[model samples]
Target: MPSTTAISVRNVSKKFRLFASPKERLMEALHPFRKQYHREFWALRDVSFEVGRGETVGILGRNGSGKSTLLQIICSVMRATQGEAHVNGRISALLELGAGFNPEFTGRDNVILNGAIMGFSRKEMLRKLSEIEAFADIGEFFDQPVKTYSSGMFVRVAFAAAIHVDPDILVVDEALAVGDARFQRKCLLQIEKIRTSGAAVIFVSHSLETITSLCSRAIILENGIILADGEPKIVAEQYLAILFSESKGEPNLDITNERVVGSSANQGIQINQLRDEQFCDVDPSAWAGSLSERFGYNRHEVRTTNGCAMILDYLVAGNGCDDISGVWSGNAIAILVKVHFSADVNQPIIGFELKTDKGVTIAGSNTFLAKTQLQPAARGDTKIYRIEFNTPLNEGDYFVDLGVAEYDGSPGGYVLDVRRSMMHLMIRRKQEKPFFNGIVDIGFRFTEVDC
Candidate 1:
């Protein structure tokens, strides 16, 4: 292993034997023919990857996709049937709830025990006990048996101990999911510190938001194989594609390419066609067949429809242009979505969201939340929905997602059609003055005040 590499796995594979019953195993053992009584199940196959110091790599996959198995091999909780994993330094792994803690031991003792297991001396662990306990903030539970702790308390103590150990490599596997929102935020901040301190972090979580936001790199595993590995955003997109295709019974990751039906843009039409509500009212029933040819249209957009409705066309208009490629910060923009319902629909809802290019959702809203009522629709019915919002965003390229669904009394309702990353909006600042520095401008006012 290179000096800079904290962890490396080369062609690692793990296999397990399955038998119908214990009797089958006994029979196979007694038979002189030595016939096999169990079939082989490969949990991981030829999985290889390396994590360098200061790099945070996220492992993403559905359940039974070898995620946990691969982590176990790296953490030495389980052995690989083939190949090996090398670690350049001590590892602090929070692979599962109560994984390292002894249920019978007090939380304080467990921390010391874990420190000792990681090669720390009793005096060293004693010195760090106060800090760990303060971070955990589990109150009296620190002196109580770990079995008395709740799920949330377990994560708090486990995460506190794991990070305080100062290992060269940190392995976390979905253990933070049990933490409360406040604690999760605290843990993420600490993880960021660990990452900056030059520790290699192998983080496994089903939360795509966290994966995209925190990890420097990402890997996708499927069926004991590495499906995709690279930049976090791209890998996340591919992972979503796989999930969507599988759920729809499609075996391939072919993105939906259904052409937008609309009238063509007139020859020599500018990309920023100034449009707003009046433009939409002029011809509600007319198909803007050429909307796809507009200058601001995103060719790489992903669209999904469930046969109930289809988003026929869309346009972004702002600052005196109907089709705008960019909007000035703090300016108001209108998004027009033309939809065609193929079947009778009741209480349909339309939603809109704004996101950063890295896939972080900045803001989103739906008709249900606004308590807006729409008339029921029949087959062949067509309507145009308009969403208007102010762009208090920093200068950068952003994306807009439009979705149509039913208000089925569920938290998310039922999605009928979705156009993700379909509309690209560029937020521009006046060249003379750049107002904000980050992803958003929260309208901060500065004034001198006496303390």
Candidate 2:
């Protein structure tokens, strides 16, 4: 049996008129008379891709790289300036929250309207209304006008409606970022259910984790062009590499450099080995971990019943034994990460990325897939997550990258904790053998025991 093709977008492109003067737009519209539009802004340039039934595909790009424009065109919320798009079934879109909503109408009213536009009948809407309400969790406020609702409520209701409509094709654009943690996970689970139910999906998101976890394939977009389209990890890694490569040339000059000031510094008293180590070890405490590359831009912004807590004090230690940062090239080492949790977080996973002195991500790993959190940690709670690996890194200065998240099998729901630049480790070459292949010598093993 062959899979059905659900969507086809051929050479789709969109262009907008840019006017140097505000009057130019007015003048051009009034034309019978010609106008003075200075330039044309091509939001999308001949972008073409196809989606198969039951397949989830991700479109990734920078802030203004046409991902949204492509989605809007395919979902029929907007028309293409050139080329054509074809969809084989009823389409549901979460392109923008409250997009087709009438603010004057109550949330309950718009829920039915949006579902009806999605091809659901009033009876069908009523049938799924409970499911939508359960997902939204907005309470009696559902009877209030949507315009008065919060951003969170708007997205919750919108996502509930989109999924409840049961369209044959679903187009989701970063709507996962809309609500709180529990809801985000709930949304991802629903998306998974939808995909499994045979609805073709076109998902656009910056969260590579989400893309890789939910979609069978991923595509990268740059400057309104398809940069790469292939496996999720390969595409996500490439995106991260390019993102850091861009971070190297110009360290956001305008952005204030927020240092991980040790607890002692803040408390006005030098306590804990961390403050002491910072003074002695030129590298900060954040770099105390053996693998730091995994944590690059790995910060999580976690919200709990109490509040939010930023995970800090990442310490990586090797078998060199004592210091979390202590490790010599060619020696057995254990990578350890210590994080301070501010609130109760369930199933928090920790990992690291190893970066060379030049900001190249060498290798990284997290317990997310391999293992699960042993316990839920609360405010002022600290835990150590450790991974042991044979010494494989070259002798050089390297940065440690860290990440923390409530492990939901899908990637989009991660609440970034912290991406700090404090931890730095120096590996001294093994005395007898200084052979360096690249960043790490991933020791491959071969055992010759009789079977």
Candidate 3:
């Protein structure tokens, strides 16, 4: 049976009148003939989606992509110009900073006031007050006016109050990103608890990892319309690909033209052909004439000094042996790295590292780590190395840094060629399985012990 729908939005659109000045606003309102003094701006257009009970849905988009406007409409903080949103149960929302709290009021007072707004009586709020305080962990700031609180503190108190009220639907709008790492982890745990308790969650964030780790489904918004909606990983990848294209001053890749490469007879040869196409596209000599010319330096971020070998190209291929723009968690994928030798070298090593946008290394591997030996390469020779495995990663944008070096018979080695931000990888959760909490999805097994 299909899950019960807890939130439904139908053909929802919002339009605001942009007045040049206060006089224009007043004139427009007073004009009996309804003379237009303001231009109309549509924040949302024909957007529709449903969130089932116990489901977590992520909204991904660029800034001003109508994400916040859609959230405000769903929370009823703002009304839609057309269409309707039907919410089945009480909602607790942490929208913009200081959204439900008065800046002049003490945090304690705001908690009680917000609780009352959520339909809890004063006594009932008092019963939950200590739990809220403990969760917020603001210490003496709890007694201070909200105006004195930091952005992080504001999020803490707001999140603590919203979650403590026992809402059937939770709407969070990039608020958790304000908190510190430890607190963010705590909030994620609480969100998981809420999901377990059957409360639907609507999360909006620029952080793809957070979205893919928490939400089972995701939607991508562009120009006030639903661009894509389905698996969190795919939607996130579409958003990133748009970003990548725009960064290079090119039009977004037409994902509609792409199809999943299916497994068939002669899959290996078909995959090899696809890989060849990928490699040819990234060839340095072809950079001036290839399709990559339109996307100048889309994959070129090289860093090397006194280098003897250089990475000529690389490819990220999906299960069907086709180059993929994005990949999903637990899906089989492959990375092919091709290197060109400029000088003879002994004990040459090739490796790759996956890093977050913040430059934190999540995982990496080198040929030395794998204890693999390869025949020495001479000048004018090229070799290809491939690694294939199932990716156990959370959804987010990641960078692949490729490097080639010669082992110096110790832990330290001489770097030959290294490229930072050489390739962009997007990983999204494909299943509605429980959210994984970390960067990697290490499938851990447990065994019972009896004494």
Task: For each of the candidates, give the backbone clash count.
Answer: 14, 28, 1
lDDT of 3 by residue, 1-451 (tens): 1448889999999998899999999998999999999999998999998999999999988788899999999999999999999899989999998797999999999999999999999999999999999999999999999999999999999999999999999999998888999999999899989988999999998887788778899998887998788877556656665665424322343522244346432121212232245464434575333223221124445577476887766666775544555566677777877788889988888778878766899878788888887778888777878876667887666677888888888542678888787666666554465567777878766799998
Candidate 1's residue-wise lDDT over 189-267, tens digit each? Answer: 9999999999999999988779978999999998888887888865765565455331322223322211122423221
TM-score of each: 0.63, 0.58, 0.69
Q: Candidate 2, residues 1-451: lDDT per residue as tens digits?
A: 1348899988988998788888877877788857556688888878888889898998877788888888888888789999899998888899876688899999899999988777778998898888888888999989899999998999999988888887789898887786898888888899889999999988888776588778898988776777678876556645543453324322221131222244322221111232324322323344444222222223222223223444434444443223333355766655545566776777777666667767788777676665544577776676666666565677555666656766676642365464534455545454566465677777656799998
Winner on TM-score between 1 and 2 is 1
| Candidate with maximal TM-score | 3
Shift in Å, residue 161, candidate 3: 0.9
251, model 2: CA deviation in Å? 19
Angstrom error of the Cα, residue 112, model 2: value is: 0.8
Candidate 1 total steric clashes: 14
Best candidate according to lDDT:
1
RMSD of 2: 17.2
Clashing pairs in 3: 233-428
Worst 10 residues of 3 by lDDT: 265-274
